[model samples]
Target: MSEQRLIELEIKIAYQEDLLQELNKIIAQQQHQILLLEKTCQLLHERMNSFRLENNDEGNEQPPHY
Candidate 1:
């Protein structure tokens, strides 16, 4: 293979490697964000359930404007 062609291939490989690393970093960040959102959703769900239970305990009080 010609030296110039080989050098071109190496340059392309380097660029591809750099792009892959950048993509990996972005994916890791997105995964972390997804995990955080999942946790927040779980917490909100639990809080809502607790609120429902509390309301049930009160046994449907009449509206304050009643």
Candidate 2:
């Protein structure tokens, strides 16, 4: 291949590699965010259950309408 053509090919390959790395990083960040959100939801659910149990012990009037 001509020298210019080889250089162009190298540049293209480098750009593609960089793009792939960026995409991978973004994917990792999104996964982390999803995991955090799931944990938050789980905690919220637990808290709600605990509050309900506590309220039940006192025989408080059930809140009108769920």
Candidate 3:
């Protein structure tokens, strides 16, 4: 290959490497966000279950006709 062609190829490879690094960082950040969201979802699910149980206990009251 010509000298100019070789330089062009090298430059292109360098750009690709930079892009790959940036994409990797973004993926890592998204993974962390996903973990945080999952934890929040679990906490909300637990809270909802507790609330449901509390309501069920209160629901045991008989009507006024008793």
Candidate 4:
């Protein structure tokens, strides 16, 4: 291939690499957020279980809806 064509191809390849890097960074950030959310959910679940146990200890009264 001609030198100009080769240079153009190289430029295109470089742009693609940069784009790929940006996408990877975005994905990493999203993964981190997901992990944080999962931890929060786990903590909430634990808290709810503790609350339920506490309520049970206090006579296990039925709710108004029951």
Per-model TM values vs. the true structure: 0.89, 0.74, 0.88, 0.83
lDDT on C-alpha atoms for all candidate structures = 0.97, 0.96, 0.98, 0.96
Cα lDDT for residue 48, model 4?
A: 100
Writing each residue's lDDT as its tens digit, candidate 3 over 1-66 gives 999999999999999999999999999999999999999999999999999999998899887899
Give one digit per residue, the lDDT tens place, for model 4 in 1-66. 999999999999999999999999999999999999999999999999999999788766666687
lDDT tens readout by residue for model 1, 1-66? 999999999999999999999999999999999999999999999999999999897878877788
Instruction: Please state the error at residue 5 of candidate 4 in Å.
Output: 1.3
Candidates 2 and 3 compared: the better one by lDDT is 3
Per-candidate Cα RMSD to the true structure, in Å, reads: 3.3, 5.5, 1.9, 4.9
C-alpha positional error of residue 26 in candidate 4 after TM-score superposition, expressed in Å: 0.7
Worst 10-residue lDDT window for candidate 3 reads 55-64
lDDT of 2 by residue, 24-45 (tens): 9999999999999999999999
Q: Which candidate number maximizes lDDT?
A: 3
Can you tell me which runs of candidate 1 are displaced by over 4 Å? 60-66
Model 1 has an lDDT value of 0.97
In model 2, the number of clashes is: 0
- Give candidate 4 misplaced runs (Cα > 4 Å): 60-66
